[model samples]
Target: MSDKKKEIDLEEIIAKYRPVVGFRVKKSLGAANPDWEDVANEIMLNVVEKIKKGEFRGESSIGTFIYTITSRRIVDYIRQKSKVLRHAPEPKPLPSPHEQIEDKERAELIAGAIKKLKPKYRETLYLYYYRDLSRKEVAQKLGISLRRVSERVNYSQKLLRKLIKK
Candidate 1:
């Protein structure tokens, strides 16, 4: 293919995979930062440009390429933020004495209950419930099958219910 044709083909592939890239980045970064969508868009644009410039040859599928680039961007963003925070002055401590006391107490109770569960159950619950991951997402993150995620979640819920009833 001509250089221009190659560039166009890369752009078309990127366009087709944009939604998938956005969804993956949004899911991975949304909880950490509300500005994640903008970050994801910026990262996607950079990835497209790199692909068009022949920097990222299509050794992987378009979707995988976008996902890998987006993942790296997120990691780099987080590392940069951490470095900034490390160099910045610490913030003032809270002045209020009783802020979120009830919430903290409830959270402690729930955490104690979770600690009583099996390791797999606890991990599954923490990832799916506390981390707010969907079943499929949880499976993907944990490197488990979707069926295993479903089973673990169901079993964990039953175990928790039984423990709570006592």
Candidate 2:
């Protein structure tokens, strides 16, 4: 059928199918369900839209076509309604005041120790740790041997520990 003719037929089909569609939806979803009207309306809308789009194919009568659409839509609605809600993770609690003060004091001790290191050891540590350079890269940048870079990093760590202890 032509598009214009199909559109007319669809409207007539909707008018005739309205009662059957309402009965099918109300029976399946129950009249007490607040969304019964919405589901019934959705089925009718699907029937009209599919018929207009030439999905009917003229093989089945309009009643059968609407019946199939209503049944499938009801199944889909139930599946959607019965789905599970996902669980959320709980948030972490705040740290105690003692932890906050200890963290601040430790940070101060580390800062003082770093400032007391000689310039070469400080440069080596800055490149290797803070700037995240490889030992070879730190050696090449500082014009020192790889062995010298490793020694400086280890020795600086020992010195910092001693200074912090004092």
Error of 2 at 68 (Å): 0.7
TM-score of each: 0.46, 0.48
Those runs of model 2 whose alpha carbons end farther than 4 Å from true positions after fitting are: 84-166
Off by over 4 Å in 1: 86-166
lDDT of 2 by residue, 1-166 (tens): 6778877876787788888889888899776565777899988888877876778886887678788999999999887766621344335445568977999899998988999999999999999999999989999999999999999989999999999888
Candidate 1, residues 94-162, lDDT tens digits: the string is 433574587678677666777899888888888998999898899998899999998998887788777
Top model by lDDT, which number? Answer: 2
Taking every candidate in turn, the Cα RMSD to the unseen true structure, in Å, is 11.5, 26.2
- Judged by lDDT against the true structure, how good is candidate 2? 0.85
Counting only residues 3 or more apart in sequence or on different chains, how many pairs clash (N, Cα, C under 3 Å) in candidate 1?
0
What is the alpha-carbon lDDT of model 1 when measured against the actual structure? 0.76
Report the Cα lDDT for residue 124, model 2: 94
Clashes of each: 0, 0
